[model samples]
Target: MKEIDCRGLPYLKIIREIKKYFNSIGEGEAIVIVNSELGRSNVLRYAAHKGYQLDEENEENRFLIKIEKRGCLEVEDEGEIFSILITREKLGEGDDDLGKILMNEYFEVLNEYDKLPKEILFLNSAVKLFHKDSMAMEEIRLLYKKGVNLLINDTSLEHYNLTDQITFGEITSMYDMVVAMKRAKKLIRL
Candidate 1:
């Protein structure tokens, strides 16, 4: 088994490193990853999302996760691979003020979907919705708790000066976004 010492590493960096490691290994091969307490849940979620069968344990002050690369995507119950990309603050091209209201309503309507989108990605101006003061906070939080992946572009957060104000989702890079979109069976851009 390959061993990865990820203590003190940020959760996203650990996720990226683990993914790189998985890409280099063959199916059925296993890796042992050690993470700090703060990163344990994120690591577990990432491993599961990537279709790795995992066995984990607490050792002293850290978590040891053994992950086997399955070489396949985890099959969702509905078997649909869909992602939503939001590049703007609103749902359509129209009045700026009204668009904000519409966007909030749109999130509320998202709950009606029988099968929620696998990922909800926010970029550019859309990333503002991830800030603590967002009107769509309630709906977005609900979606997150319901197992939908929420991703916010790091560049966008920086541009909006909201990198520190965000209260939800994983802050992601362009590379991550591109990779995720490529793997998505269906992608909706709004």
Candidate 2:
């Protein structure tokens, strides 16, 4: 298996699209861009929910997403993940107010899907998602119950004085974040 980077591009769609594209090309490897840690996680978590075999110790980073193997999509070969890395807080840069609104709608979309992303992560100001009584907090709770892996930055909790306030997900370091990204079958942002 080879890896292709679809960073800043539409990676998820590309994966599905490749299944069709490869009909002509036959066989090859591809990568999909998932620029955020949360995005990377969402994909992996979704894979797990579907009952795909994931390497337990590498669960956080390397996602064993089997497209052709699962009978979900018809492809010539299986796939492997090299890694995924996310550092930014939001999917895009713009007005914070607008970004929040957009992000909320985006989560709503994710929630509506029959398959949710592998995980949701909170970092920097994005931790505000888990802030006390935020409007989106209930949705976070629902997603968590639905088995979507959730995480928050340990440093963010300390810097924002949120240790006492955050009520969702476990705390993680950059090391954990890197592992999750590296493990995803695909990554998404926004």
Candidate 3:
């Protein structure tokens, strides 16, 4: 069994790395050592949600999680996981007003889905949507609350003078966003 040391890693990073490794190997057994309660909980939950077989050994302030990849959860479409990239304040390159309206409608529709994209990265003018009174704020907030990772580009937020206006999501660097996009099975741009 492959052994992974997850010390000093955030829970999300641990989960992402495990998922990536499982996808690459197809089937494998591995042991992960985690040192935080939040990390332990997230790791277990992720394993369960993806239908992997997991056994755990609890220690003082640490956990040894054994994961055996049986199979992945049943997805409607096989072999596809998605991430979303939104770089504009609006949806299309048409009339500005109509584009804004379309973007709002798009976010609302996304909320009705049973499964959301793995993450959503906002770049450029898209950061505006997280500011107060923004039309798409509520819908995006709902997605955030539903466990869809909402990330806003730090540079974009600063350039747009929206540094202090964020109402949801966490500020992220371009490097982090690029890594997530590259690691995702598919990336949908808006």
**Top candidate when judged by TM-score against the true structure:** 3
Compose the digit string of candidate 1's lDDT tens values, residues 1-190.
6788788887656766786788776776555455566688888877776667889889787788888886667645677779999998876777887888788877776763446999999999998887777788888899998999998999999999999887768999999999889988999998
C-alpha-based local distance difference test score of model 3: 0.85
The alpha-carbon lDDT assigned to residue 124 of candidate 1 equals 95
TM-score per candidate, in order?
0.58, 0.52, 0.59
Q: Model 2: what TM-score?
A: 0.52
Return whichever of 1 and 3 wins on lDDT: 3
Candidate 3: list runs displaced more than 4 Å: 1-75
Assess each prediction's global lDDT (C-alpha) against the native. Answer: 0.81, 0.55, 0.85
* Ranking of candidates on TM-score, top first: 3, 1, 2
Poorest lDDT segment (10 consecutive residues) of candidate 1:
28-37
Clashes of 1: 0
Q: Write the per-residue lDDT of candidate 3 for residues 1-190, one digit (tens) a residue.
A: 8888886797557866786678789788899899998888888877776778889999997899999987556435654679999999899887999999999988876875546898999999999898787898999999999999988999999998998998668899999999989998889999
Better of 1 and 3 by TM-score: 3
Q: Could you tell me how far off, in angstroms, the CA of residue 10 lies in candidate 2 after the best superposition?
A: 25
User: Considering lDDT, where higher is better, how would the candidates rank from best to worst?
Assistant: 3, 1, 2
The clash count for each model shown is 0, 18, 0
Indicate the residue-level lDDT of 102 in model 3. Answer: 90
